[model samples]
Target: MIGGASAYDGTNCKAPGNCWEPKPGYPDKVAGSKYDPKHDPKEINKQSESIKAMEARNAQRVANFKKTGTFVYDVSKIPAAN
Candidate 1:
């Protein structure tokens, strides 16, 4: 790599690391993270929706990286905190 920069993982994130690692308790059905069918319905449902959204976003980032070698950020895409 030029300037000795390490290979960028999907979204310019450092490769060979757990940058893609999900939160401990998250059950990502798409990313194949731990999934407990017996998990509480309320918690699972809530987590599932948010997890799915995040997975979609990250997948897009990875795809963009594959196409352009980096993720192009647009701050307007993010929702502001309350």
Candidate 2:
């Protein structure tokens, strides 16, 4: 059964040569720390722009497919059928 994100126990690193090491959690504890909003507006804007560009490209591809009944294929390399 699946549980919430924090339900599963993380790695145990009690002994030497173990991979796990304690790292500071999000909004890390520090002296005189000030809290800021988690989301970045600049990053969000960039992501939006990327999504719009992708949509435009996809529309263009669809239009091309409609114009040409034959679809593009890489005849040089064929995928293995399992």
Candidate 3:
């Protein structure tokens, strides 16, 4: 051991401050390998709908500006229920 008796155990670390093994009881598989949003059909559909809504809003804004010849600012109410 370079630093101390527990610094570089051959089964855990190579030398001082170098560890090769995962923490005890950690998952063996890689993170996000399962249940990733990119691989989920429902998540993909929801994301597609959100993107479509955004595009529609942008198109509406562009059309409004073209028709009125001025920029319109939509200020949301602080407490939307009001």
Candidate 4:
């Protein structure tokens, strides 16, 4: 007979014919799927590009502020934090 609680992540299949085993404290249905970077390479590249662009913009803003001794800002305009 199959015995013991299964791993919560369901990445492990303990023994043979024990597929119906239950995991304690975590329901089997809500576990996230295993990560596969190969499945979404374009999305990953887009995110990477966006991060690089933001870093470059921030560095430029900091350099400009240091040189001019004044930071540009408008109280009425604020970028929403996504």
Candidate 5:
């Protein structure tokens, strides 16, 4: 027998089953196909560089606002949030 109920039994599960099996990690890559960063280290580097640049830009904006009391993107033009 596969536990208590066949599945849903009207109000409750007459026979609740296990949630799911735990795997090492990843589903698509399990079939011996994984994305190796070694093959595209440059792309990885580019992604990292993009993140750093974004953080730096955000930091600069915050600093500018603290000093000049203004946002990098003009929110004054937009209607005030309700």
Candidate 6:
């Protein structure tokens, strides 16, 4: 009617030109590496670093709150811990 029959054909429709196709078992690959998902050491390290930074920031906020009865909403606003 409006667009065409392919528009209403759902997933069964075929593209006209060179269309992008998803790789098989793409979900199993997070970083697109052969040793991805199972052996993602780099990603794990990054997450651990992030967690450590968050923990340190929270500790700083808590110490600041204990000293002065105001909770810091932003980590950047928190004073440097000495």
Assess each prediction's global lDDT (C-alpha) against the native: 0.61, 0.58, 0.59, 0.60, 0.59, 0.73
TM-score of 3: 0.41
Could you tell me which 10 consecutive residues in candidate 5 have the lowest summed lDDT? 13-22
- Of the candidates shown, which would achieve the greatest TM-score relative to the real structure? 6
Tell me how candidate 2 scores on lDDT. Answer: 0.58
Question: Can you give the TM-score per candidate against the true fold?
Answer: 0.36, 0.41, 0.41, 0.43, 0.43, 0.47
What does the lDDT come to for candidate 4? 0.60
- What C-alpha lDDT, on a 0 to 100 scale, does residue 58 get in candidate 1? 79
The deviation in Å at residue 80 for candidate 5 is: 29
Candidate 2 residue lDDT tens string, 1-82: 6677654356665775565654656444443445444667898799889999878666655555566664434322322324
- Mark the regions of model 6 whose C-alpha exceeds 4 Å error after superposition: 1-38
Off by over 4 Å in 3: 1-20, 31-39, 70-82
lDDT per residue as tens, model 5, 1-66: 687765643343234453343255745343445633345678769988999988876776776677
TM-score preference between candidates 2 and 4, better one: 4
Model 4 per-residue lDDT at 51: 94
Please say which candidate is ahead in TM-score: 3 or 5. 5
Superposed by TM-score, candidate 6 places the C-alpha of residue 51 at a distance from the truth, in angstroms, of 0.7
If the candidates were sorted by their lDDT against the true structure, best first, what order would they fall in? 6, 1, 4, 3, 5, 2
Better of 4 and 5 by lDDT: 4
Q: Candidate 1: lDDT of 80? A: 41
Q: Which candidate has the highest lDDT of all? A: 6
Which residue runs does candidate 4 get wrong by more than 4 Å? 1-38, 73-82
